[model samples]
Target: MDVVVGRVAKAHGIRGELAVDVRTDSPEARFALGSVLAAKLRDGTSRDLTVAAARYHSGRLLVRFEEVLTRDVAELLRGTLLLGSTDALPPTDDPDEFYDHQLEGLAAELADGTRIGTVKEIVHGPGGELLVLVREDGSEALVPFVRQIVPTVDVAGGRVVVDPPEGLLDAD
Candidate 1:
């Protein structure tokens, strides 16, 4: 149930602080001071780190881990993924909103109940987040994660209803 909440952007300062590119919508809660996080490094190793300090600088999140006490160590953490469990995160107050973890693996069907595929992963990009759908033929489709495109998300029922517009599902 470990979900990636952030990625190490780069070393912030000489004092082991790290600039983080937050992936989760709730960065304040996910990267709070004194919060412990589990991480998987690029080399396939794992470590548990405690958030020694966290601050915002010009709207960017800066964090310092107690274990990473030097700028060199922090620099090595670039591209590292910070993990948090879903149970520890605050519940979503907006009923229409759903976390990325909740959408992964859900069956995606059309409005007329056509079984298109299942959600493989969520791709976060500059434009917005997209739902990666894998079909039975093993082809993939990137569906925009918007209310107009993805109207319904039934997490409890394990299904997502998509309303794709013309040419949306076409392969380019």
Candidate 2:
């Protein structure tokens, strides 16, 4: 399965190298030479790109593709999503860890069978990951990643059951 690892932030220097806003545990460790990446371009097409070189510079992942060779080419790739196969990723050392890819589109519910919403996205912040849940009507809710709230996460069943406190989901 393709897992989103990063996004092409902007063009680095005059070269075709891209500065990626990494969203992984070890950014430098994820994108290695010869690694194949699927880039989701702005035109809604996916391109298979071979990693020529990947390194860390100025708190960002500097990535160069085999065919991308100029600022113009790299600029076109800006906002493009860098995706890699889950098999290529190293196993997580943390037991409680969950990948962002696994959380996307999962059903959100309560233990009592109250269907809350579907996970639209996971937002990483100072506290932790905030689950962005989108209801059927297109309204969104931000649920804290606390155990008291999100008591269960069933990736296999594609669901995350939450037990939100009073006024939690009640908030606009």
Candidate 3:
């Protein structure tokens, strides 16, 4: 279960540093020094890369890979997805906390137990996280991943109880 930790946004400098668009919540652990990440390139090839160094610059994550020593080589890595295994991640201890993978694919249902849709993915934005749902009608719905609307998450049961407000699920 390889999860995307980040994507190479662009080459940051002449020293092969890459500006990365982080996807994971635990970027510190995922992009730690000496960490090995699988870089899935846009062309469908994958390569193992060792983290030489990582830093934050102007609110963006900058990373240098041991294999990428030139700016040209780093530029080639643009849009490459950096993957980390789920096996390396520890389970969350907080009852309210869950990894995005855990919520994705879960059945979404109303409080009354009427199934409405399936969770497509979790979108992390500057405002907040949103649950992208594939509704029964094949339309998509964005539900704010907040406690007020999503009251129950049964990971073992493979379902989530949604208490969406009026028109929240209505198709546009």
In order, what lDDT does every prediction score?
0.89, 0.84, 0.92
lDDT of 1 by residue, 1-114 (tens): 899888898998899999987778677788888888998899999999999889989767899999999999998999999999898976889899888889889999999989
Model 1 superposed RMSD (Cα): 2.3
Per-model TM values vs. the true structure: 0.85, 0.81, 0.91
Lowest lDDT sum, 10 consecutive residues, model 1, at: 21-30
Lowest summed lDDT across 10 adjacent residues in model 2 is found at 22-31
Checking candidate 3 for backbone clashes, the offending pairs are none
Q: Where does model 1 exceed 4 Å of error?
A: 56-60, 123-128
lDDT of 2 by residue, 1-172 (tens): 8777889999998879999887655456568788778999989999988889988786567999997999999999999998888787667787567878778899999999789899988876657779999986789999987778898888889899999888888845
Lowest-scoring 10 consecutive residues by lDDT in candidate 3? 120-129
lDDT of 3: 0.92
- Sequence-dependent TM-score of model 1: 0.85
Per-residue CA lDDT of candidate 3, range 117-147, in tens? 9999887788888999999999999999999
**Candidate 3 residue spans exceeding 4 A from truth:** none
